[model samples]
Structure formats: C-alpha cells, structure tokens
Target: MLFVDFTPPAPCVGDLNNDGVINTADLAQFLGQFGQTVAPGTGADLTGDGVVNTADLALFLGRFGQSC
Candidate 1:
C-alpha cells in the first residue's frame, strides 16, 4: 500500500481573512493596513518586506481574483 497526502495548500497571502478566496473583502483588508508594518494581527505585507508598500500591492494585485 501507498500513502499520500492530497490536501490542497492553504490560500495565498492575499487571502488575509483565510477565507479560501481572494476577493473584495481581502482587498479592503489589504487597503486598511496598506501603510503599516506587520503589526500584532494585521497581515497585509504580501512581500514579506516588513512594510506594506508597492511591492506588496503588486503581489496582491497579481492574486486579486484568485480562488485560493
């Protein structure tokens, strides 16, 4: 017998709410924290650059309509 894991990976970083989809809600969330660093609970830093800026915006735009 063979064992394997078939579970899909977690949603993209853009899915800020972990809602399994990257949509307006996530966008709103992203915008809400667009100028701050990685705070206690905010997660809008899509590029892991320690700050939310164009880099993270670009990455978020890339996955704006993604489903995961």
Candidate 2:
C-alpha cells in the first residue's frame, strides 16, 4: 500500500480569523504571531511553510484589503 502525507492549504491567505475576509483583525492576528511557527489553517503562516516571518508578512501585505 502507498500512503501520502497530504496537508491541506489555508482556505485563504491573510485571513487569520477565517471570517471569509482579510482585514484589520487578521492583520492583528498575524502581527501577534509574527516570527513564529504555526500550523496550516492559521492565518499567521501565509506561506504555509510552518513559519510566520517577514516573508509571510510580505505575502500577506500583497493580499491586504482583499476579501476571500
């Protein structure tokens, strides 16, 4: 038998609160978790690489003010 390690992607990038929109709340959440490693589905890790750093922040900035 064959097995695959599949991890689902975040529903939306920068939508930390998962309120179906990327707004200030998400921004706050991201900032709070900045420079840390968080699991997928959590808006903190925008890159989905398990780390919340400048790169993720940058990606999130690109999606800022946009709704999912």
Candidate 3:
C-alpha cells in the first residue's frame, strides 16, 4: 500500500492565507475562512498563538498586500 501525506503545508509568514504570497487574494481567503477552525498542519495560524482564530485573521488582514 502507498501512503500520502494529507497535512496542509505551512503558510508563508507573509502569505497570510497561504495562497502563495502576501496580497489581496490572501486577505480575501482569510476573510472567507474567518471564524472557522483551521485544521491541524494548516498554516492559517498567522500569529502562531495555537489556533487560527479571528486574531490571526486580523493580523493577516492588517498586513494584507504589504511587502515582506
């Protein structure tokens, strides 16, 4: 049998939503998932506070589209 990893990759520190880079797209993505629980291994936890809550979303939005 073959095994495949199902864990979501880490989000780029600047890539708030983990879509790829820090931009409006990321901001939109974060907003879409706002108030939702990010699964384990998902990099939605921008603040690294433990869970992907509104705080993290806020942080992401705050830096939305800002350069690294």
What's the lDDT of the predicted structure labeled candidate 1?
0.83
Candidate 1 weakest lDDT stretch, 10 residues: 39-48
TM-score for predicted model 1 compared with the true structure: 0.81
Over the stretch 1-68, how does candidate 1's per-residue lDDT look in tens digits?
Answer: 99898988854678999888889998999899888888543499877767888888898899888886
Q: Please report, as a residue range, the 10-residue window in candidate 2 with the lowest summed lDDT.
A: 37-46
Candidate with the larger lDDT of 1 and 3? 1
Using lDDT as the measure, which candidate wins? Answer: 1
Q: What C-alpha lDDT values do all the predictions have?
A: 0.83, 0.82, 0.65
Write the number of the candidate with greater TM-score, choosing between 2 and 3: 2
> Residue 16 in candidate 1 has what lDDT?
91
Instruction: Give one digit per residue, the lDDT tens place, for model 2 in 1-68.
Output: 99996988557878778788888998898899988777864658877788889988898899999986
The CA lDDT at 39 in model 3 is 63
Off by over 4 Å in 2: 1-10
Q: What are the clash counts of all predictions, listed in order?
A: 0, 0, 0
**On residues 1-68, what C-alpha lDDT tens digit does candidate 3 reach at each position?**
99999988754564754456688776676667666666643556676555777778677777666664
